[model samples]
Target chain A: MQLTGGQMVCESLIREGVEVIFGIPGGAILPLYQTLPEYPKLRHILTRHEQGASHAADGYARATGRPGVAFATSGPGATNLVTGITTAFMDSVPMVIVTGQVGRSAIGSDAFQETDITGITLPITKHNYLVMTAEEIPAVINEAFHIASTGRPGPVLVDIPKDVFEEMGEFEYPEKMDLPGYKPTVHGHPNQIRKAAKLIEESERPVILAGHGVIISKAYDELMELAEKAQIPVVTTFLGIGSFPDDHFLSVGMPGMHGAAYASLAIDQADLLIALGMRFDDRITGDTSKFAVNSKKIHIDIDPSEIGKNIPVDVPIVGDLKLVLKVLNERVKPTTRVDWVQHVEDLKRDHPLMHERDTDELLPQHIIQQLSELTDGRAIIVTGVGQHQMWAAQHYTFKEQCSLISSGGAGTMGFEVPAAMGAQVGRPDKVVWSIAGDGGFQMTMSELATLAENKIPVKFAIMNNGFLGMVRQWQQIFYEKSYVATGYSRNPDFVKLADAFGIYGARVTEKSQVKSAILKAMEHDGPALIDFVVEQEENVYPMIPSATSVASMIEEPKPEEIRQ
Target chain B: MTTTESPKHTITALVEDKPGVLNRVSSMFRRRGYNIASLAVGHSEIANLSRMTFVVEGDESTVEQVTKNLHKLVDVIKVSDVSIQNCVSRELALVRVRANVQTRSEIMQIVDIFRANIVDVAPDSLMIEVTGDEDKVDSLQNLLRSFGVLEVMRTGTIAMDRGLGDEQTDKDNSSSTHRMESGL
Candidate 1:
């Protein structure tokens, strides 16, 4: 059937089973917006900003196992999506970005709203296309969706010229793609699996270091089985928080900077580190030379390049995590390391994650604990990067796969609000919470209006420390406490800001009010914000300083010593 | 850990002949912090595909990582570290030298010794074309430098596996031919 390029886009999206897209309509994309009404089943969310649209799409993609779609016009509209695109790329989220460019004749003339989005996004995207003609719309759309959703998924952009969107063409969606150069290996080689199994069987101190790959590959069950059958401890990376049941006996919580001290100690003492679906990023591996120095490593991932990209591995298996774990689970035998388990328990007992309860000031950790308790540890917790992010990662007990969605690799601030909106929209049945530090919250607090506009009942918790808490912590520890620009002399009244957005708001200055504020936000039935005024100088403990090994973690000072 | 001297490596890739494929491949190298000494891209044997050859200076681990990263790109069909393989390599350089009537014969003699051709001639300059490995081209350029070489343009390094049967041809027949026939 013959259809205009804009119509072809809608048709192809329907074919790809995309039910909703987040974007704003502008001059170049007016044709698409005009055609959008024809397809009543496809929902178009009008975000206040292009960045919010991109991040909402990303959140939707992460919450659900489907590729999220975002749309924008050219130039500034396209550039605004760069941070979200890089975030999806860094975390390997499946997303398709559509941008409308200037007319073909005026593309190189630097016409209004004309940007080389394809060129700008080249390095970050898995693949991108610039459509010059309407005839190529259907095929390009099909390819964009295919590339974005398959083989270690990431973002893909399709920039359509405005003229082409108005032109007519024969619309034909191919049933299957014939991408010869883009095949991903989905099964592990038997020989390599066996070698990894042998390493698992022979080692007495085996530890399974899981990462976001575990959630991406949907191998949570397999991961649990492998950890259980081998009787090995499991420690999750920051993004891998929900991959394993936190309350399980084998679970050792998170490990790295701001990770549990026991988890870091366990990794340091392990003889075999079976890294699954996670890169040994610098945050997880404090000092590369000293990171699991004695452990023989087994790294498995879908992307072959990630196998040896960081620390050297003795057995490298390149394939899907679920498939590799299934094979390894069958080959490996049930074993127990009673002494190793004892040592881990002792470490946890000696170094418990705690704050000074005697202090009258409201604590961030206390607020998180109350929020987690109020939500029954089941809310989808999303966070902006900083001290609050680390506090949430340490405090929240995530038991659901993909329940905690934070910007890991990019460490993007202001990611919490819109991402929570996306997550709430994707999973309406579940409660979604956006936790941000004072510094990070102000970055995108405008999204509170987005929440009220969309009526997305995502709860918000802003840790009001009155300073850039993480940077201040670093300055205090690394420098001579030169406060510099870390401290904010004044800040906006968050409750008033929320109230101005027509959302329920409250402020909690005392620890006694933390629980009630969280419960009130949860019961609001609409978006609500709770500003918890936390201690300003408080720091995240068990920090492995830069260039130092995990063994050199700095813990909280003793109460008696602090008094002196 | 054992350390080795970083050396120049000739790498070749077969990629789908599509818009922005070159940009995608080049950007991958740049993003990964790999220094590309030279790069050349052109049509290959099959339609809708192009062959890219580039020289990179790196150690064994860096080269391994470069190849692995190149393979990860969706447009790249095949990546080969031709430097390590038993292969035939060549680079073409067009050199313009300051040669007058007096030094013209001397420059020609030196070019002839390297089996090069003087493609263009003028009153004050001569354009010489030399095709060989990097070292061979380097030697001729060195001898011509005494005559004051004005300009040099090199088509990096292009290579093919050396054997009775071409590995790329065999691999392409099994995997890439069907896609080309499908016209995707």
Candidate 2:
């Protein structure tokens, strides 16, 4: 049973059901890479950068609901994964990160390629370890995977020195993780569940604020049943985009800063709020003083810490959403609310979220809307942060649970390219598209080379605006239109960039060419990109000004009509 | 969510006796912007487990968040906010004071009244060791300050519940026995 630390890693990961590892090999990690060829079952996708590797792992985890794995060398390579690691931490994505360090004797000696990755990722990861000896490798790796994939899942890092990887170890995998401090509560208290059920049955106007926890717990069916049984409208948070079907009858759409007007309005008027697996982020409840003013909240989450962290709750049930909802569904009375539904409908009709359709210039919303329909509203849509992210969330109708994989908590600018590639790799059966803004596209367009090399078939839809559209809109609204460094007027040709990667590329500057270009990219096979030249100054509507009440959401701009 | 500040609360935790457990606990306090009034860490009653006591200053919600976040760490075994419980807390301080011939008797009188022991004696200085609550230590330091207190070393407060609750908790919660059975 003697094995090298590198073999123990491979064997442990195999036992954990890891089929692929997204990573890059370097000086410190060479020992592990040398052993990688011996194990062909672990498909290693070589990314251009460690950042891309970590983000791809995040995307894979989000797409599959399994812990995604990433590997990197120490020093700069490990530091580069910081943003991606923080992104997963913020969004609660399950990821296991393995980093190679310098030889044990050379550690902390300013040795080449030696960095304290476990220390650097301490605040972000659920748990992390620095394997001191070859013997601890198997157990540490097992614990890393277990911690990453359990409870309120987040990334976990395990740092291994080069000497340890080369040293021999007894490699029996630990079947169970025995960390006393790591137990997660899964079942709800009966009293709390009963209180929630009573609240649900009594309230005339109820809105279910479904957050990312629902998706992580895969409580889609239970959520639907609860909403149906109680006839409550469901409003998803940005990260909770596809937790419930976008086209479901009870779906009122997303609610937040740039969320749907009707969705926010519904929350403003609701008598009771059932917040499931979603934290009351500031973005969701802008100006917490006035948010859901009259609603009594029932917060259910596996993490006890998240309840009352932001928004105060009336009935807080600490447990897994699926189990809590199962009991809650059993206790609640089934009834329909006609007046509440009609009121929400009226709000939806009064404050519809729409983009300018009469314009001849290619609108990003139009392109996303068209793409959503063309792909049958089933493609896994990933987006970079900015105007394009909001546009995609608003325009595209997500029909499947966890179908939209985008940076929510971290809001990383260059998330689209690599995350889409990872999603496509994880779910080969589903079509994956990267809808990125022009400014964010250039930040990580190098990932396109990884896409082409791996033949990852992720379609790219770059919303080619001349500026960082979101920032530009903010400046226009708040800073007297001084664009500053927000303009990327001399951006590179995205089609040409895609072509350089040996991927099919197309350009669409008019509305007429949009559908055809998307179709052409879809037909090209391996990987494809389409550059849609969108309006330069388009704004995401129904935006509640930063930290303000949803009551201050700007439906349409008025000249000198600024509120006090 | 409450930004209002309040008096300090004594929080205690039983954590794994790992090399970086203290760093993990302290780092989270700094990251979450929770101010630490004082901290004490030592070997606990159980083998391979360390108990940490932190006096943190924040409002109800913020302190609740601090405890919750601390519990989130995989190395932390159990946490208790002893401020809300019937707990006995103590701090140990060794105060070195300028004890000249004229002030020596006066300093001895003060130390005797405070029930403190003069652990070390020098020609012009006396080191008094006092073990009590923080307030008692603070009072002793104040009395010795006029004698030109040369230096002082203080161990931050440690606390324990004054009942059977803690003993029962330790019996039920100690996972020190739950070790990873490494065949190596």
Clashes of 1: 0
B77 Cα displacement, candidate 1 (Å): 0.8
Could you tell me every candidate's TM-score relative to the true structure?
0.95, 0.95
Instruction: Give stretches of model 2 more than 4 Å off.
Output: A557-564, B1-6, B166-184
Clashing residue pairs, backbone N/CA/C < 3 A, model 2: none
Q: Can you write out model 2's per-residue Cα lDDT over A45-111, one digit (the tens) per residue?
A: 9999999999999999999999999999989999999999999999999999999999999988989
CAPRI-wise, candidate 1 is medium
Q: For model 2, state the Cα shift of residue B34 in Å.
A: 0.8
Chain A TM-score by candidate, in order: 0.98, 0.98
Instruction: After the best TM-score superposition of candidate 2, give how far the Cα of residue A308 lies from its true spot, in angstroms.
Output: 0.9
What C-alpha lDDT does candidate 1 achieve relative to the native structure? Answer: 0.87
Candidate 1 residue runs with Cα over 4 Å from true position = A560-564, B1-6, B100-102, B164-184
